[model samples]
Target: MELAIGIILGCCALGAGICMGIGAIGPGIGEGNAVSKACEAIGRQPESKGAVTSTMIMGCAISETTGIYSLVIAILLIFVAPNILVNVLLKAIGLM
Candidate 1:
């Protein structure tokens, strides 16, 4: 029983770490690309800097949602999944 609980908690921690690590990669790359392109656009058309900047900001915010979602899921896995999994394990072994 102790082993099982330890495994469950360990797996949850591992999963959360993996989830955040992978999830952050996309947004980091995307935001970098978006900012680069936005800078080029502003350079090409200084008069349209306001519009381009606003659009870039909006797009970056939208792109960041995926990372935020992963963060939420990671939080759930670290804080919530282990308890639920342990309860299920206990029930399966007829101990609960």
Candidate 2:
């Protein structure tokens, strides 16, 4: 029972780490693309730099929420999953 619990928790931690890693990838790519395009636009139209930059910033901010959500999930998986798993295990084995 103890070994099973340990394995389960370890897997959960690994899953959380993986989730964080994958979650970060999309935001990173998106932010990079947005900034790059914004800069290119600014270069093409210096008179509209301010507007372009502000819009790009807004877009980046919106894109970042997804990464933040993933991070929250990862945190929950890391910290909360183990406790929940333990409770479930306890009940399953009639210990609860």
Candidate 3:
């Protein structure tokens, strides 16, 4: 039972780590692509620089929300999962 609990906790931590690690990739790529395109647009039409920048910033900020959620989940999993698991374990063992 203890071993099972430990394994569950470990899995949660590992999953959280993976989630944060892989979850960042999409936003990173998207932000990079957005900036690159925005730069190109500005280069082509310097007069539209301000508008392009503002739009790019807005788009990037929206795109970043998923990464932020993943980060929050990762943090919760890292900090909260173990405690919840421990509590469940204790309850299962009739010690809580």
TM-scores for all candidates: the values are 0.92, 0.90, 0.87
Error of 3 at 56 (Å): 0.5
lDDT by residue (tens digit), candidate 3, 1-96: 769887988999899989999999999999999999999999999999999999999999999999999999999999988889888888888988
Model 2 ranges off by over 4 Å? none
Q: Cα lDDT for residue 86, model 2?
A: 91
lDDT of each: 0.97, 0.94, 0.93
Error of 3 at 95 (Å): 1.6
Q: How would you encode candidate 1's per-residue C-alpha lDDT over 1-96 as one tens digit per residue?
A: 899899999999999999999999999999999999999999999999999999999999999999999999999999999989999999999998
Order of the predicted models by TM-score, top scorer first: 1, 2, 3
TM-score of 2: 0.90
Error of 1 at 68 (Å): 1.9
Instruction: For candidate 3, give the lDDT of residue 54.
Output: 99
**Model 3: runs farther than 4 Å from truth?**
1-5
